[model samples]
Target: EPEVTQTPSHQVTQMGQEVILRCVPISNHLYFYWYRQILGQKVEFLVSFYNNEISEKSEIFDDQFSVERPDGSNFTLKIRSTKLEDSAMYFCASRSQTSSYEQYFGPGTRLTVT
Candidate 1:
């Protein structure tokens, strides 16, 4: 079995600074996504990528945010300018092409902006 993995489990940044969260999804997965949980709030979908392009994105994924597959196996989310409100647990998820619809999630990268 394989799973998603993230780096810099915890990240602290200054407001207006840029930060990049990295994720390596299962090798065989086809769909990838980025989500965030703001402490006590529900998980919010940020963006999804497929076939080397963005498949969908939520309003929360604004101009400041971008996602890319920098390599064959690595998926990354970049926050151009960190904001205090961006503090949260950012999760990386991936799913296969099967009908199961089961998404494997990474432990998550906690981003704290001050």
Candidate 2:
């Protein structure tokens, strides 16, 4: 079975630097999403993309964040300028048309901004 894969399970970065979190979503899915969770908080949706445009984005997805499908299989999230509050577990998810509302999440990329 195919699954979402994330790189650099944990990362520590300076407060003003940049970071790129990578993900390989399930091979046959059409919809993709990014979500983040603070240490003890609920998962908060960041953005959802389909057909190369953003379908929806939460208030948390500010100008500092961007996402791209660099290729057929790779999806990436880039934070242009990191802040201490940016520390969290970033999750990548995908769902196919057959099951658009049910999402399968990656193990997650834990980013530590200090």
Report, for every candidate in turn, its global Cα lDDT versus the true structure.
Answer: 0.96, 0.94
TM-score of each model, in listed order: 0.97, 0.96
Best by lDDT: 1
Model 1 bad stretches (over 4 Å): none
Tell how far residue 18 is off in model 1, in angstroms: 0.4
Each model's RMSD to truth, in Å? 0.8, 0.9
Mind giving the per-residue lDDT tens digits that candidate 1 earns over 55-80? 99999999999999999999999999
In model 2, the Cα lDDT at residue 92 comes to 98
Candidate 1 all-Cα RMSD: 0.8
lDDT of 1: 0.96
TM-score for predicted model 2 compared with the true structure: 0.96
Best prediction by TM-score: 1
